[model samples]
Target: MDMATTTSTATHTSLASVTLEVADPEAARRFYGAFGVDTYIRLRASETHSTGFRGFTLALTVSGPATVDGFVAAAVDAGAAVLKPATKSLWGYGGVVQAPDGTIWKIATSAKKDTGPATREIDEVVLLLGVEDVKATKQFYVSRGLSVAKSFGGKYAEFTPGQSSPVKLALYKRHALAKDLGVPADGTGSHRIALGSTAGSFTDPDGFTWEAAAPPAPTPS
Candidate 1:
């Protein structure tokens, strides 16, 4: 079944904001605030019957191991459950955490060592949707006028965001994403998330919805 009734198709979409549907908006707001990511996403109340992996994750690409560790620590202190501890791997240092509201987040970096003092600075925030078929989903977004910035055959694809976009969009195989996040692959019901953009609203092939909305106002530094 479709997650929600989508209204229109997306065109020239750049991910301006992401909204997470939570059961407790106030609690979520508190958690995100303590975790230092409240400014990156919005929240709404919904008792959506979502379970297991939601087929997506918000990935934080930061500077180095220290930064990754710093974010992971903050999330844990903010009431997030750690799915994986920050550690160095073939890719780099990173970890996974499930927010109090059931959203999964992966904090990672390509640099294995600390370059300077740790800070709450995010280099890039990518919204990765786990899809059944990477190629088909990539084509769907392409038809919607989202330009492809990176493609790895059937394994993954990423879209180029407009200058004003706050988040970048990417696609990966569903099962693979779950494995990467150290979670099981099976899931059902609402994704409990929405992507906001300048483009018109539409549901993607994987049931992820994009809405017509302005980007989030820039938060004071």
Candidate 2:
């Protein structure tokens, strides 16, 4: 759900697109694109990453409570099912929605009360995976070039974003993740979120997918 960063020559993990497989790519784009930044919609499907999540959620950090409400209302209007209505949450004002594509979306603001219009409506997209072994999962990423900005024993861990990362990647212990989503921790198999890298295609300890991609082209001088 968060990250810890540092200087390292071999921090090989680059922040990549957290690709979601949907029946209709256009529809997914229209919906999620509004709530997330730099959302890349792919028509090509990955057999492994296409399976919907049994234990995960994508979170968007908004600027304030008012923006949180506004976005949730739009999601509900577009036929998303409300899992939790906008309200003051333990972590400030927040709400949840189940997208038509069967992905869980959460909108939250760090401020508890209305803070007016958001300067940036969609701040970040966090790929929160529910893992059976957080420590093992954390190590798997580290070996593949991910750097940890912060970690806690074996319950949770966060990865620092490499250049070009569009979304944040994180791991949480299974039951704890379930608690965060108000669901059961009895999920296994495909997580339906793909972490892409120029590094190549492979699967993580929890079976979440990551694909091969070239590093982003640098901006002109």
Candidate 3:
């Protein structure tokens, strides 16, 4: 792998979008669109499919269903434990699965949100982690007082540590996560986890970085 030549054009904040390399372009498009996300770009040969949002983008690329199946199989073959086999959800179209790395992937339609006026109030912040082992990582955090909100398989998982003000910490396999971020997997540990309040840092089992942050204090009334 070329180390020095790594360049990323993707510029978005939070947990942007998890891109899955699949087999069918149209099917993947329709699958995500059904979740209410608009498909902005589609490329056949490059197998690139992109969905746009006000602040982020989710992408998928595949030749067809068979190809997607093969990719899933490859993950399993590579020692990735399936957290959830690819299956449809009651809420909408798409499927959910986990990899051995504790990365949970939801290959579903875009999530639909009720229209509302924008406010200064924060909605959510996404935390990303690269781990050597997903299962062990999940256990480490859970033992540290974090609660598992959801687990897909060995590939990915999500933990929520708060209620009124929520935080989402996601764990992903190093290599697959590198591909999603379009970067190299050699740099493990917390790449960057954001918090909505006072900024604080925590280290996971793999020495990944994590943050608990808040906006700067405001002037007294």
Candidate 4:
């Protein structure tokens, strides 16, 4: 099969939005939107649907140790399942939380390995793609015009987004991600999220869906 490309393909530098089809959009909105001004929760595509890992994760990168701790604490307090408690790693200090929406969040701080007092701001946010075949998925994105910032032994990879790139993207082995989340590696059924890009509508090698962002409908006078 041919690689799918969008009609109005988003540039490598645009922010991509994740569209989740939830049983209760209102509940999703209340929970997700509270995290930040940018995070959004909208309507579902269908009344009947399924939900799971969805092959992606929401990463909140912070510069302060307090910020990471605060974020982690807040996530847990807000009904998130703690996947990994706050700790230090090669990349820096960080932890993982599975939000109520089934979106896994990695709260991290590369600036300091030590914990500190609470801070309110975030350094950056990234959308991480978890796939069964890390190497092949990395190749697919590379072929699609994205450049890599760093890479590891066919297990982890990071891509540098153009200045205009909306959301920073990365790739990780699905099983490894499952291990991180403390869950079974096997995930199936519809991913239950839609991505709209100026780049256009296309399906990835892993079955994640993307479409062009539709303009707002005109209101009647």
Clashing pairs counted in every model: 1, 3, 33, 13
In model 1, residue pairs whose N, Cα or C atoms come closer than 3 Å (at least 3 residues apart or on different chains), thus clashing, are 8-201
- Quote the positional error of residue 138 for candidate 1 in Å: 0.4
How would you encode candidate 4's per-residue C-alpha lDDT over 121-178 as one tens digit per residue? 7777777777878778767766665567767757777776646335677778877776
- Residue runs of model 3 more than 4 Å from their true location after superposition: 1-124, 164-166, 188-202, 209-216, 219-221
lDDT by residue for model 3 (34-108), tens: 322222222122223222111111222233333334444544554444433543335433333343222333332
Question: What TM-score number comes out for model 2?
Answer: 0.82
- Whole-model alpha-carbon lDDT for candidate 1: 0.87
lDDT of 3 at 159: 59
lDDT of 1 at 152: 82
The per-prediction CA RMSD against the true structure, in angstroms, equals 6.1, 4.3, 16.6, 6.1
Clashes of 3: 33
Q: Which predicted model would earn the best TM-score?
A: 1
Residue 162 CA error for candidate 3 (Å)?
1.3
TM-scores for all candidates: the values are: 0.91, 0.82, 0.38, 0.76
Better of 3 and 4 by lDDT: 4
- In candidate 2, list every pair of residues with a backbone clash: 4-149, 15-165, 198-213
